[model samples]
Each structure stands twice: as structure tokens, then as C-alpha cells.
Target: MADVRLFPRLAAVHARRLLANPGISTGVDPDALRSAAEPFVTWAPSGGRRSTNAELDRLRDNIRAVAAACGWPGPAGQVSRASFDAGMGAFLLESGYLPVAEALRDDVWSWIAIALVPDVCLWRFEGAAPERFLGGRRNTLQRLWSRARVFDRGPGEEDRWELLDRLTEDAMVQITERPSIGADPKLAAAIGEAWVRTAAEVGASAMEALTREAVRNLRITNEVLCFGALGDADLAAAVGEHFQRAAAATASQTGQASG
Candidate 1:
């Protein structure tokens, strides 16, 4: 766990300007991007440390190495989504919390996506919005770091990994973005398992509707309930009830439509 620092702040205006440029967005040579981005970065004074130019380069190298070891068979573009998820998840787990936290910042991640790994960004997010390079949620490295932070529930948690593997990309994004459940590991796992079970019991069409409804209901419940006070079983039961209601509603809708 190295002491991490904040990346020098790039004003929102400047950041948008950079992202709007066709050369940066369309993908330029990594060296050229780095040189262009260098002037905008200022290392933090203390508390956290900024990633240096050399450190960013090392990170890129490490990403490639990990991809290779994980049998990703890259050029980055060729890596399967599942393989990329697993490999990046493993990388984030090994990266420790501090670096991951720093990487979460839009400034740092923007630099990484736009300057360091633009090719990977373009490849992985082809035809996607520019936000893929500029936004925290869509940034390639930031999203992986976020996924690892939320789902990699630590030692003796192989079951968590399995649950994660079972999730659709849409499901993963949904669960990860929900602050009410995403911030709590127990809640996240319980909700995930419950969602999977509900999907199994009702099938995919119902599951999508159920998931959407359940998440909406849960968000409302979260406002009034102190979910943290509930034990694991209770929390799980609470989540299950939401899904059960959603399933029932979805079934009714389907029946009426068929009728």
C-alpha cells in the first residue's frame, strides 16, 4: 500500500475542451497524449500522492502484462468482456485501496483513458459517447476499480466472485451504481443473489422488469429505513420481499397482456 496522492486538478472547462478535441477522443499516440497532458497535471502536496508520468507508464505495462497472464490475447480490442472484467478485477484487488481511490477521481481517470490507454478505451468502448473517456462511471479503469471495490468482498469470498460472474453487464452496472446497496457488501451480495434467484424462478423477461421495480422500490425504502441496523438475514429478507413483489407485479402484467 503505497501512499497515494490526488491528481492535479484539471478544471471542468479544460477537461471538456481536451475531450472535445478530435485527436484526443479519436485516439492519438500514447506518447503524444502524455506530452500534451503533462502540463495540466500538478502533483499534490501531501495526504495523497499523484501518479507520476513514469507511474502511469508502469500501470499501462502492468495492465498489458496482467491481460497476457490472464490469457486476454490482447491488443486490448480483442479482449473479451468477461476476461477483461476478471483481469481488471484482479488487478484492482492487488492495487490496494489507496491507488484505486485516487484513480476514481475524474482528473486521474481522464488522463488515464485519454492519454495513457486511449487505444484500449477506443477499442473497448467503440461508438460510445465521449463520456467514456471523461466520466468516472464509464472510464475503463475507474469502472473496474469500482467493481473490485464493491464486489471483491475479500478473503473466503469465492462465492461473491461466482455471483459477480453470473451477473449481466447491465446487472453489474445497475448494482454498482446504486448507492443504497452498492456501498454495503452484505446488501450487495444479498440483493445480487436474490436477483439471480428471482430471475431463475420467473425467467429473463420477468427478471428484467422485476429488477427494475425492485431497485426502484429499494431506493425508496432506503430513504426511510436504517438498513445498516438490520442483520444479514434481515437485510436479505427485506431485499427478497422487494423482488417478490416485483415478480408478482410483472407476472400480473404479463398475464393481462396475454389475455
Candidate 2:
């Protein structure tokens, strides 16, 4: 993947305003939007040799295909939404279409969300916050990319991305909302895997409590501990222990101990 072309912040803001315009529910035509977006595309700092917009086609087509199974947008079913997210996450990470460094830019993501696949974003989020359409942590696509990159089980494992499907949105929010855990892939995956195992053992009812406690505990511990320095087994064990303790506390509070 070469350097990415960015859509200007001004264009992203204008695109967001379009959502309020009546009849936006029908969705914007991607080709037309792409043509309109051309003037706003920026190559400041020389975006490395006349980049092509072919990836935009792939993104638009993938949105239709993925959204089709998910009830064609307009607030799809939860299961389908999650499935769609996982599919897109895999696409972003595996498609070889974007460089990781370039993908990190909020404006580049804004272009994709607004100009490339506004229909899908509008369909998925509907009346949700503006950030979902813009970029940054809450952007619909950016979060999925983060999830896939963070939870991938790595090269040697079969179905390396299984962890992405395992996480529920609430559990994810607890991790992603806190920069201490979400920014570090190894740490985030450790916490995610630990959350999954602990939730299973403690039952789903305790998951909310377990994650809350675990995130809080980890945040404080991370100030003194360097989880990044640990080996895989050690990291998992540490994360697992933290979750177990959180689960135990939750069980005690609710009077439903797993052990």
C-alpha cells in the first residue's frame, strides 16, 4: 500500500451536514460523491505518485455486499451489524489496500466514511453521533480496523481473527474507551481474551461488572507495570488473573460465585 490521499477536513464537515438534509436516508450515490470529492482530495507533502481511487470502488462494493446480508442498513440487526463489522475489519487489515501509517490519519478515514461509503455509515449509525461519520476513535470504520488489528491471534494460529467476533460492543467499549488498554494490541488482546474466558466462567450477567473492574484495575496497574515486556504466556496469565479477581468480586456482590 502506498501513501494515502486525504479528504480535507472542510469536505468531511460539509458531508456531515448532508446527513441533516432531507431524503438523506436514501443514501448518497458513491460514484457521484467520489467525483464531487475529487476537488477536496489533498496530496500535500506529495502523496506519492498520483494515487488511484480504485480502492474506493472496492470499499463501496464491499459495503453493499456486507450490508445486504445485514438488512440493507437503516439500523440493522445486532448480529448482522457485528458480523458486518468483523467482515470490514478483516477487509481493512487483510485487503492490502491501505498502509497502516496512512490509515491512522483521521482525515483519510473521514474521506472513506463520508465520500467512499457514506451510505453504509449512514445506514449503520443512523442518528448516532457525528463522530461515527467523521473519524477518530468513534468512527465506525476506524473502530473496526482497531479491533481487527488488536485482536488478531497472530500469524501461526488458525483463524487468527476469531477474537474479533467474540467481543460484544459493551465489552469493547470498556477497553476502547480507555486508551491505556486499547492502544496496545497485545494488551488489548490479552484483556479481550481474558474477558471472554472470565465471562464464560462467571456467566454473561457478570461480564459488565468484570470488564468495568478489570479496566479500572488495569489502568492503575499499568502505571506501575509494563505488560508489554511480558511474554505471551506471562501476559495472558497476568490478564487472566486480573479478570478472575474482577469476576470474583462481581460474583460476591451478586451472590453468584462461579467457583
Candidate 3:
């Protein structure tokens, strides 16, 4: 993979317009969209240190090849989230962290989703929300990169992708998007382990309810606690306590409702 570079910041304006076009959201001719996007993309200094149009094409081709290899079929074809996640994870690892991180800007992602690989975006997102084209925690490429970065535990560790396998999509998104969790691998894994256990013990629906509460508790706890300063063991212990409390509260609510 080539080093990823960013387009000029002003390109974001044009990128947004392209994304806003309804035709692109449903699906557009990839070649046509690429042509439109070409004008807005301005490579960085040092002879396009940021990504070039050609690089974007290469990246899209690479994703398609990986998807095909992994059997992650497109919209008209059968699709598996597990296959897609695994394939994308491998791609991210190969792409290297620095270049991928540098290209994570909203504008860059926007251009890529709108022009480079809108089909993949539609396939992954089911052609629903515009966030797939725009930028956010839920942006297709951004989400994939963020998930891989957060859960990667290095060699000889548990496969972090299992978190995606276990958690509900909403749960995974909530957990992965938070700064405290997403930015720290150990912390994310710790919480993810706890969440998986909780889900297995209490069922997915109850676990999701508990997870919402846990997210709220995390926000409040972070106000006084320096989670970044804590070690893995300490963070896990803290999250464990919160999980227990949330689980208990969820159980109590369920009991009351049933009664």
C-alpha cells in the first residue's frame, strides 16, 4: 500500500456537496463520481505527500479484491459482517497505522466514500444513512479503522475482532466511538471482555440496556477519574465495577417490569 496523504482542507466543501447529492447516496457511476471528485482533490506538498487520485483508485481496488477474497459479497450478493470485518482488519494492518491515521480526516474519508468506493459504503451500510458518506464515528471507513485500532492487542493476544463478533452493532459503535475507550487498546479490550461476558450471562438485549447505563456511568466517572492515567488492571477493575452495577440495575428493572 502507498503512503496515505490528505487533500487540501478546502476540498471538504466540494466533498460535502458530492455526498449531499441524492444520486450518490443511492448509487452513482463510480467512474463519473471519480471524475467529479478529481477537481476538488488537491494533493499535499512534496509532490502529493497526501493521497493522490490514483492512490484512491488503488485503495478502492484493494478493498474490492480483499472483499472478494473474503467472500464479503456486495448489495446484490450475500454479505457477512464477520467476513467484512476480518477482511478490512487485514487491510488496515497491511496499510500501516500512520498513513491510515493521517488519511482519517473527514474530508479524505468523505471523498473516498463518495467517489472511490461508494458501492462498498452502500453495501456495508445498506444504503441507509448519509453518515456513510459524511464523516462521523459511524463513517464506514473511519469505523473500520477505529475498531481495528482500538481492539488490536498485538501479537499472541486475543483477536480483537471478536468484539465485533460478539457485541450488537449499536453497542459496538457506542463503545468504540468514545474517546476514553477508542483511544486505549487495553481499556477497550478490558471493557469489551466484560461486555461480552455480560451479554452471554444476561442475554444480548439486557446487555445492550446495561451497556447504555455503563456508557453514562463512564461519562460521569471520567469527570473525576483520570482514566488515561490508569493501567489496564485498574481500568478493567473500574469498568468491572460499573458493569456489575449496571447489570444489577437492569435486572432490578426487568424484575419490576415483569412483576
Q: lDDT of all predictions, in order shown?
A: 0.69, 0.75, 0.70
Model 1 poorest 10 in a row by lDDT? 70-79
Q: What local lDDT does model 1 show for residue 102?
A: 61
> Per-residue lDDT of 1-259 in model 1, one digit per residue for the tens?
7566455445455557666667654445767766776677655467666656566567788776655664544444433766677667767665663354566567767766766676666656665366777747777777777776666657776554655465667677667777777887667777787877887887755566678888889888988997677998898899999999988998899899999
Model 1 residue pairs with clashes:
4-48, 4-49, 5-48, 5-49
On TM-score, the leading prediction is: 2
Q: Write the per-residue lDDT of candidate 2 for residues 42-152, one digit (tens) a residue.
A: 643655444455655755687678777777755577787888887778777877566676677887777777677777887777764568867788898988887788887
Q: Report the lDDT tens digits of candidate 3 across residue range 1-259.
A: 5644555432557867776677865656878877877777754555336655576567788887766765545443433665676558656664673365455667656766777777777777675477777666667776777776666656566664676556666777668777766766666677777888788878887787899898789878878987777887888889888898999999999999999
Candidate 1: give its CA RMSD in angstroms: 3.5
| Model 1 / residue 239 / CA error / Å | 0.5
Task: Please provide the root mean square deviation of candidate 2 (C-alpha atoms, Å).
Answer: 3.2
Candidate 2: 10-residue stretch with minimal lDDT = 2-11
Ranking of all candidate structures by their lDDT, best first: 2, 3, 1
